[model samples]
Every structure is written in C-alpha cells, then in structure tokens.
Target: MNGSVFSSCLEASLQGQAILNDNGEFLFVNRAFCEHVGYTKEELLLLSIESFVIYEANEDLMKKEPIIKRGMQQKQVEKLILHGNGYLQTTLFTVTDVSDLNQGYYHVQLDKIVTTFDDVDFSMLESKLRDRDEVRLPKKILDGIKDTIITIRLDGQFLYANEAAEKLFNRSMEELLSNDFWTYLKQNNDEELLSKFYQLLAGEEYTQFEVYKKDQDEWFDVRAYRSDDQVTLYFINISNRKKMEKELKESEMNYRSLVEKSPETISVHNGKEIIYINPAGKKLFGIRSFSEGALNLSEIVVAQDQARMRENYRMLLTGKKEMTNSVYTLKRLDGKKFDAEATTTLITFKGKPAFRTILKDLSERKKVDDLIRKSDKLSVVAQLAAGVAHEIRNPLTTVKGFLQLFQKEQEVKPFYLSLVMEELERVEAIIYEYLTLAKPNVESVFSKIDIQVLLEQILTLTKAQSNMNNVTLEFEYEQVPAIYGLEKQLKQVFINLLRNAIEALTDKGTIHVRILKHPDNQVCIQVEDNGCGIPSERIDRLGEPFYSTKEKGTGLGLMVCYKIIEHHNGVLNIYSEAGKGTTLEVILPASN
Candidate 1:
C-alpha cells in the first residue's frame, strides 16, 4: 500500500498501533499509540520505539530482534514504557514483520495495558512464534544498502552479513557469516586490517581506514564502530575515486615536467615570494635551488624596474589585466645583470591567485641589436666621408691659398689673417661634427634639448652632402619649446632624415626642413624632399628592417632612426604620393 492509505488504516484503528522501520524508527503512529506514549504524532514520528522503552526492557527486546528479523513474530511481550512526564507503564506489545506492506516496516500492536504483573505468564509470552511466511524486513533493508555492512561478536565471530558484503566477498550470506572476522583478515594476509579490528575490539570505540581488496581488485573505505558486545563495519567502495586521484596526480606531474623542461625561464610567484622556479629560471639566476632562503621577487629584478614589475604583477593577480609584456634588467645571485623580456600572466597556483612570469633572455639579442645600430651608424658615416672631405678640403684650400699669399709678401695682413683663421675654424667644426657620428656610445643620458639648435647643427653637417647631390637644404622654424630626449640620438634621427632626403633626389632638388610647436605641447619637425618621390604603398615599408627604396640600401639606418625616435616617446610618420615629394614628420612631447 502507498504511505497515505497505510497511514489512514493505522490511524483508524481503535487499539494503539504503530509502524516502524527495521531500525525501530516510527514511520506511522495511530492516535491510540500517541496517547499511550504521551507524545503527538509529529513528536513520536521523530523518535524510535526504543525512545520510550526503559533500558532493561530495551535490552531484552534487542535480544529478540535477531529472531524477529529471521521471520518470527513475538506476541504478548511485556515491556515497560516510560512516558514523557516521568512516569512508566507496563504494556504488552505484539510485533509482527510487515515488510509485505512496506520494504522494511514492522507493525506493532498495543495488545493491552496490564494493571497487575500476575495477569500474564512471562514464561509462555517470552517464547517466539515461528511463521515461515513472515517477511524478513531487516535483511531486505540491509541488502538494499549500497555499502557493505557486517556485524561481528567481540570474539571475532561474524553474526550478520548484508548482500553487499556477500557480493564484495563473492560468497553467500551463510558462508560469509560462518567465517570469523579475524580469520578473514588472516586469510587475506591483511595484517593491517587485523590490527585495526583488534584496536576496535580493545575499547577503541571507533576506527576508520581504507583497504584494497586484491581478489576483487577494488578499493574500499572501511569504518568500524564498536559496542559492548559487537563491532559493526561499513565498507564503501572507492575504486573510481582512487583511479581518478591517480590520473589527476599523473596529470599534475606531467604539467610540472613540461614547465620544468621549458627552454625559457618560467617562474611562479605570489606578491611576496617566489613559489616555484623552473630549472631554466634557476640557471638564469645562478642558483641551484631556493633552499638558501625565501626568494623575494625584488632580489632578482633590478632596482630600477622592480617598481614597474610589481605593479604589473599586482594587476595580473588581481585580474585587472590579462597579461603584460615588458623588458627588464635582472640580476643573478652573483650580481651579474642581464636583460630579459618578461611576460606576466594571471593564473591559479595551488588554488590561490598568483602570477606566472616567463622570461626570455634578451642579452644576446641586445648585443646583436647594438652591433647592428653601430654598424648602421658607421655605414652612414662612411657615406658622408666623401662629402665631409670635400667640405673640409674647400676650407683647407682657402686657408692654404691665404698662407701662400702671406708667404709671398712675407707680411701678415689683418684682413688676410682673419680670413685664414676663419677658414681653419670652419675645417675644425667639420671634423668635430664628423667625429661625433663615428664615436660609439653604448648608452646615452636624456635631457632637455633646444630642437631648433639641434636641427641647425644637423643642417650644417648635411649641407655638404646636399650640395654634393646637387640638392638645396632649406631650414624654417618658429620658436618652440625644448623637448626631453637624448641629444646624440636625436642628432642621429635628424641626420638620417636629411641624408635620405639628399639621396632621394635624381637631380637638383630643394629639401625643406621645418620645426615648430604643435597644438598639444609637442614639437613637430618635418623633412620634405622635392625629389623622386616614394610610391604611396612603399612609404609604409620605409622604416622596416632590410627594406629600402634605394637598390644598395640595407634600410637598417631608417629603422634605427625609427627606434631612436620611439625610444624618446616620439612618432615618425610618412606622407607620400607617387609623383609628388614625400614629407617625413616627427612629433616629440615638449619638456616642462
């Protein structure tokens, strides 16, 4: 029957009646039963039948439970029931297995309340009434459970076994119960299991551990709880969980192996300390391991870039940024500094927010780049040699002619001496300008520069080259603010622009150069050449490495010029038309 119809039938009964699960928990209680227990249906439903039974009677009832569970019904059993108001009554009950009505329910009928102890004979009532047709409700419930359950006596004799236990051991209930618990452990050669069972038997109250069943090839998480006379064990299968754990462990190991063997230096760090560093990172830092002490992030990064690195790392860990790319100078454990480009990204490390940084060593790359810049600088200087010689030769020839005239007269005239001195000073200026380009300066300091004056000096240096190309150089300017930049680098940029302008011309052409203050506190410099103009599409590729308009040009010179200008936080743009001249404009932020 469904729960409602069964509950209604029990509720309509005049005598005290209750339905209980195999564990003696009340599933349904009639009005008569509620009155007998002095509890509401709601209150009694929350309790078990034993909750009202006195200790001595409960123990006596528990003794008959095994017989009742084996399809025997106890009739007219005398038990003392304690009321909620601190009173006890002698009641007679008849408990019948009702598992046919429900899977694991027992029907208990309150036969009568006895006024005197002499009314019933205890000897005949204590005898169990055997009914072979009685439902074995407890066995059905225990067998329905997924986990293996067993009850064993203190002397290691197995008393009860569930279907799960029988299935787990691949034996029948009769066979499983026939074997003692200690004998099972001994037969399996499980000394650990035997010891744990011994611990439970020796007043341990509770013990739990995992055991692998070799014959079954499965893992079981076992828990045992002890009582005065018996210990109950529960074995929960954990084979799937164990297999997944193994796979996850292997995955983690594989991931760590991949990161450890990476060619680039890979490091994971929280804000305060480095959590992990790969072999490449260790080698780059000149350390065998981090066993020396906590490796603070500041210890490896150079002081100048540390603040920037910290900010970027914080943003990554906070999820404020996805990733950051920057070049930094890092110092090894031995204090040798090297350049590296680091990419920082956000990641979860061991279930917490952290930053992972992959550093690519830029030392060799920087060296090659330096060599290229130096090579391109020398190349430009060599090309200028002819024009510079021609420039200096003219002045030297003038001075020599004046000296020859003086030697002939054997007297130095003031006008002639002044002219000769002026020519000699012109030659000195030309040589000094030439030497500045030839000198190799690895690093330069930035400072405020007068853009107009720098341009004037560059024009003087390129004037000879322009003249040699049969080109005219025109300079125009409006008073503008100084820009903050490296003076030598700025000179290189302007010289490259002027030389390219001079070389663009096939015949006589005018190269106009102008400097002015732009609208947004910027200094604008434009170099326009009225020569064989560049094609519109090709202008975009002008500053790319190894790409040039001239047949013999390496194009590295213009690329270096672009790099220098960008380093100074400036922009270089080209505007060109096929038949028209090209204008290369540079914009630099003005100094305060």
Candidate 2:
C-alpha cells in the first residue's frame, strides 16, 4: 500500500488514529487523533506516543520498547490522553502492528472517549460511524480502568459496573448487578452517600467529595454526575495525598497547642495592628480578643511611648532589625499603665511578615524593688538603735550632772553652763543622723553632693556596727567634684554598701572605702573588703532580690543599693573571687 493512501484511509476513520514506529515515535497521526487530545497535527508529529499516552495499568510506556519491537498488539486497553489544556480524558486504546502497510510502523486507535456523555449527540455519533465495519469494543475497555466506575438508574437501580467497581464493592458482578445501589447503601447505613446519590437525581450537575474506607484502609476522591437519565460515579484513590494532608494538620495542631499554653504573653502584630495574641497575652492586656480593633499599638501603648513602640514594630516588620529588646509603658484595657519588656522578632504569620513580641510585665518586680528599698532603710535604723541609744545616754548624763552643779551653786557659772549646752547639742546631732536614715520616703530633690563628705557621714553611722563586727572601716578620697543627685538616697546607698561589707567579715577584716575622680569627670566610689569572698556564679547575681552570699543575709541591702545607684545614673560593678576579697565599684557622673 502507498503511504499517502494509507494515511488518507486512516484519516477517514471515525475514531482517532495514529501510527508509530517500533521506537514509539509518531510517524503519522490523523486529524481525529489531534482533536481527541486537543493538539494540532503538526504538534502531535513532533511528539512521541509516550508523550500523550498514560496507561491505566501505571506501566511506563518508555520502558516498553522491547515489547513494541516484538510486534505486541494491545487491545481495548484504558488510557488517559493528555489534553492541550492540561487535563486528562479517559479513552479506550488499541494498537496493532501494521508492518504490511508500512514497514516498522504500527497503527493505533483511540475510541469510547468518556467525556460529558450526557451532552453527547448520539445521532451525530451514529452518522459518523455509519461507514465503519466494526462495532464498539466490549466491556474490556472499561474493565481495564483503575478508577471505579458505576452507572445507576434514576430510581437507584444498578445499571452497570466495571471490573474495578467489583473490587471496590467487594462483590461479584452477578451480585452487584442484581441489587439496587440505594438499597445496598441504606443497608450499609451510609446516609451521606445515599443523600449525595439522591441529590444527583434531583438535577444537580455533579457532586464531588472525599470518602474514607476504613476496611480497605484507603481514601477515595469521588465524583458523581448525571449521565442521560442515570448517574455515573467515579472513585479515584487519593489515600497518599490525604495522609500527607492529615500529617500537616496534626503538625499545625501541635504548634497551636504550644502557643496557646505558653505562660509568656506572645502576640503577632502586622505593622498596623495586632493580628494574633495568645491566651497569656489576652490576660496580660486585659482584653478578650485581638480582633477587638482596640489592639492597635497607639491604643495599647502609653501616649508617651507610642512613637517608640511603633518604630520598634516597624523595624521588626520591615526586617530592618532581626530582633529587638526594649521596655515600653503599655496601657491595659482598664486604662492603667504598666511597664513591660517587649522582646520582638520577625516572623512569617499567615504567609506575611509580622512581629512576634513576648511581653514580660515589670510592675510586680518594680513593686518588690521599692519595698526592698524601704525595708533595707528600716533594717538599718533597727541595727543602729543600740548605738544611737548609748551615744545619746552619755550626753544626757553629762547634761544632767551639769544641771545638778548649777542647782548646787547659788550663782550660775558661764563655763559650766556652756559645757551643759555642748552636751545637749551632741545628743541632738546623734538623733539627727538616726532620723535621716530612718526616713521612709525616697527624696527626689537633686543637689550638688560632695561624695567624700557623704561617704564620711555613712562611715560615721556604720562605725559602731563595724566595731561590734570586729571589722575596721576606713575612708580615703581625692578632691572629686560634687555629684548631682538625691542626697538622702545616696546616703542610703553607701550606708547599705558599708553595712554589707561589715557583715561579710567572719573575723577581723578591713573595709577600705575610696573615692576617685576620673579625667572624664566620672566619680568612682570603691568599697573593698578582705572578708570571705563571693563565688563566681553568685557574683553576677549579687544585687538580685533574695540572693545573697551571706547565709543569714536578706540580700535586700545590696538590692536597695543597686536601685538607688541606678537612679543616680551610675553603674555598680562587683569584682570578687572565692577565698579572696570582694570589691564593689560604683561609677557615677559628676556635676558639670
């Protein structure tokens, strides 16, 4: 046969036709073949047989070169033809060796294409096939499919089922074809499935959903559509995809659990507003939901710090800074301002850049700090009680004895009266120093303080305590400039420092207090003790509340000292080592 004549004959056939070489390369393809796969004739010629043919058997067509060379003729096989628009069309495939017509070329036929069969014009199909001598292929085409296909009447009676449907239903063809689909569904107590079937009969174009078969341990993506007066259902196994989705959901749930149960206030803010807040955040902010519109930064942060907070958020969201740690005064829903430390980092939330801030409330910590200061001052006054009483008694007795001398003499002696007045002034000075330390309120008034004279006064007050502890307190200083600060608070700070040094001594030890002025005008007040030294680990935590090196120490004294020095814009540094002595250096800015 001539090649052009054979091609003309193949093109006249109603069914789609293509001819391939032994290598599965398309040698010739008819217009119908191109229409079936929604590709042009020229485009199909450029492609190979394996390019468009997907086997229902999941076999690799490219690896079937040996079989094709052996003159294999596969009949009534099911395949999914690739369409130009990237969708699959189920069709019956047939390939036969046609070496007689053209050496090394094989003829392929595609028929029974399962499209929207409801809209198919049977009259036009018959007219197209009138000239063909052969009839449609048997049920082998449908049976070769992997997906379960079944057809039912509008009354729910089973009309037809493929071989795959038998395995799906776990029944033979005789049993399945003898019963009604709805009756079987009802007996199985599958109300959802039965409802979908009825809904298809009620004129729905199609119904689709996923169904799990526990007995088979499989998941199926099902689609049912009206086909003429009956309905056809297609069930495709999607267990692998479904399992992956299940795992992703579980991972998301685990993440949510961790976030929801966290004790720290965690929240996510998109540059403009807060999008999410954990349970701890809701409680901290005294709000019910983040969706409440009032979660804007301007509303939540105090007016004074709003600009700073907004800038911090902007920096985090825009990736200007990877993370930020800063303190802000935040306002609660109840209209109260509380200080919080916000540690923020950039994160992807709901697929967009956002800020995750963890807020730590400092209100309670501040209160504890204030109470420690007051308590430390009161403790100092209590410890000074014995010393103050003894000092006052000696002066009172001298004044009493002088008054008696005045009473015994008829004329008053000026020298003896002056001695009595001097004793009374001595008593008054002792009382004044005692009352100064015992004052409860922190003085906020800033003044030019002579650091040397302040240290002298503190050493004078702690002198009795140091003597009783068998510790010697010594003070030395350069002619440093005065520091601008609250005098009373500074007195309490040095007093606490001196007392701690005195108490640290187990046996006789010397505490050297020295004030040095740096060229930059920074004052350094050094307190060194030759007592049992602090361990390395505890040195860093010296000023923390309730943390102390001494066994009976409350640690409030050092804590109060640190707080006061910090208020004076100074840094308190502790240098210590075990079995050696400890040195506390307080650096403060001097008056300009």
**Residue-wise lDDT of candidate 1 within 488-592, one digit each (tens)?**
878988998888888888788999999977655678899998877888778758876447898745465787777777666566768777768889988787886
| lDDT tens per residue, model 2, 1-592 | 8968877898898889888887777788888887887878887776665565434343554553232444656645565544654345676767777676446867778866875334557444333322221212114345667999987777766666777988988888778877878887877787778777767767897999888787799999999988567677899999999989999999999999999999889888875688888899899888875573347887787654554555556556556567878788888899988899999898887797777889999988899989997879878666556556666788799898888877888667999888889989877755654454345346567889988888888888888998888888878888888889988788877887787778777778999999997544578899999988888887768766446677645455676677677667666778787778889888887787
Clashing pairs in 2: none
Candidate 2's displacement at residue 424, Å, is 42
Q: TM-score, each model?
A: 0.48, 0.43
Cα displacement (Å) at residue 455, model 2:
39
Residue 511 accuracy (lDDT) in model 1: 92
- In model 1, what lDDT does residue 96 have? 83
Worst lDDT run of 10 residues, candidate 2, spans: 129-138
Could you tally the backbone clashes for each prediction?
0, 0
What Cα-based lDDT does every candidate model obtain?
0.76, 0.74
Error of 1 at 124 (Å): 15
